[model samples]
Target: MGTTLLGIDTKEHCFEAQFHPKRPLLACACITGEVELHHFDRENRTHELAQSITSHSKSCRAAKFLTDSILASTGADKFAALSDLETGKQVWRCKLKAAGYSLLALDTERFAIGDDDGGLRIFEGRAPKAAVSWSENTDFISDLAMGVDGTSLCAVSGDGTLAVYDVRKSGEKGLIAMSDFQDDELLSVAILRRGTKVICGTQTGVLPIFSWGDFGDQKDRINGHSMSVDAMVKLAEDSIITGSSDGKLRVVAVHSKSLHSQILGILGEMSAEYPIERLSLSPDASTLACSSHGRPSVQLWSTEAARRLMEGESWESIFEVPDEGAEGEGAKADPTAAESDDDSSEEEQPKKKRRKEKKKGKKNVPGSNAKQHQAAKFFAGL
Candidate 1:
């Protein structure tokens, strides 16, 4: 089925989940400020609980893997903390002026944090001093992402600003550029093509792409989902996957060789009632780990197949689509859909069959986490 459910869900809601970059580790932060770390055993297809940490006093909104043995987390507690995953010990803690909402690891010794009141702070190593702090009248920062080079940082604000900071310089010099392409809140921001094109997932179901250094009018807008886009992860340099509150996971093509981007297909999906909470890619980019409210804490699937499907391959051509009718209880195998006239003039993917299916059934769900946690015993091939 190309899917595996790992880790048991706790009573408290899990706000974020991540997979380690260089280790076989999966971690999640709950509303109760509890951080759970697990070891994924690809050989046995099982996950073992590695540690449960109570580092924050309140909800841990964001968590990212810094190193194989280090994790960074922030929440309503108004502090950012680094913990040793091996021992589940709090190694360093830095208090912010306001509640922390987003966290991004900038480099080996520097990390960035976004807070309520529209604040963005940068810290170097364990020093308590904020190497830099900057913000305008923007509302709480909804998301933060570092450029592939770690030399630039991009942040989305509650008000609709997508700002990029050049951390290479200190003080106000670091404030590079910003764009308010749409008035609606931008829930997510991602840098593509090194730092040329910046994409933001807006509240209005659109992914607005802006050229770096000059955030004027958007270069293009990718119509994504019906609901607010809550999370996104770059699948390949030119491809991305988005999770929305409307309960859909979409694979969209970007930075195409022809310079045209479009929705490739849907990977995994859920309902609005339990929107996806987080999405993590394994170190090898082979397995994708996902989390959603009221569902399993972790869901796994093959990235290779999703990639093939993105290239316009068929379900059977990729793998079995999962037959639910024959099994009666488990996922039923879906009938192979008739090929569509992809020659439609509209650039948008057609929703003709989707509209019909929608009229036939009803459901809802939540989103994914990017930049995950780390731990021991690397996931040995899945």
Candidate 2:
């Protein structure tokens, strides 16, 4: 068992892209403040650009689909907005004074927003009031993720500090401050192993894990990456999918009942020529999208088989194509390509004719406006 590479046709780079929890949808926040939502036609084995949402004034750092129809995005312009995916209308927008860089959608009225000035604010929906606010050093808060418990959250800082917050407690300290590992600034943080452990990726490719409530020492420290981790998302309870400055996607296996600390190997690594700016994974963990820095190029990887490999299977290569059953997805790529190179020597093909979708009599979902027009075409030739 190995990995399959899905080539997404796009000429835009996103800061981060995410798949809907229960829908066949992919949404990305682009560098130009335009959020692109894509619909994957699984029945037809095709995809189309569903909508291009332009609401932010600056580059959006994070975009996520709260429901199949509701989307949330945080921009560098110090604004966090919630949009109705079906109607394409901004439902609520929060304007912060500091430059906001990260966001996590809780419920309709609650969100965890991180800013460049090292501020993490939990505010009610549509209301400009803060319920819980936490700030560490002046380091920029790069990313924010919810703990498995649903009430607690973790905020990773540019100063290599991991701030844990339990909404139940109102103290400023909140409990633990893991500050020993300062090899480089931490960029991404993810809680794994059923929310019992906290794992973070650092600038120098260091993956450190801390037990819940006790962040004084690392439970396990895995190494081998030569660049900073730029994007990370949880693939499984014990597995983490990471994209780094070197454009490499790795399945880092943490300690668990069936596995030890291992680097299971690369999932969808391209040439290190272009650093990976953002990465997204489907709720089923079937699809993975990795965006490159300034190249306007992205790769969608299938991790179904890769999970098998992580489960202790051995494979020579995980770079096969799903439909063609080809030996290598990047077969035409130079063998000497960098960490995550691609097959870019091919010519672009004309757009595929629009296929009429299957009509269902049920009421349209909230994000149906996204289905009316194909905003952008990705992997037009694939």
Best by lDDT: 1
- All predictions: root-mean-square deviation over Cα? 12.8, 15.2
Candidate 1 at residue 70, lDDT?
83
Q: For residue 38, what is the lDDT in candidate 1?
A: 73
CA lDDT scores, all candidates in order: 0.65, 0.64
Instruction: Write the residue-wise lDDT of candidate 2 on 1-382 in tens digits.
Output: 2333544555455666677778777777776777887777643557778888885877776787666778878776788888888788788787776767777878765777787767778777567566777664346677777877687677777655566666655545442343433445667888887877888887767888877755544667887666777778888888888877666677777885676776666666644576676677766767787876534355677777558767676444444435454432211221332544433211110000011121222111222322211211111222
In terms of lDDT, the poorest run of 10 residues in model 1 is 360-369
Candidate 1 shows a clash count of 28
The candidate 2 region of ten consecutive residues with least summed lDDT is: 346-355
- The global Cα lDDT (0 to 1) of model 2 is 0.64
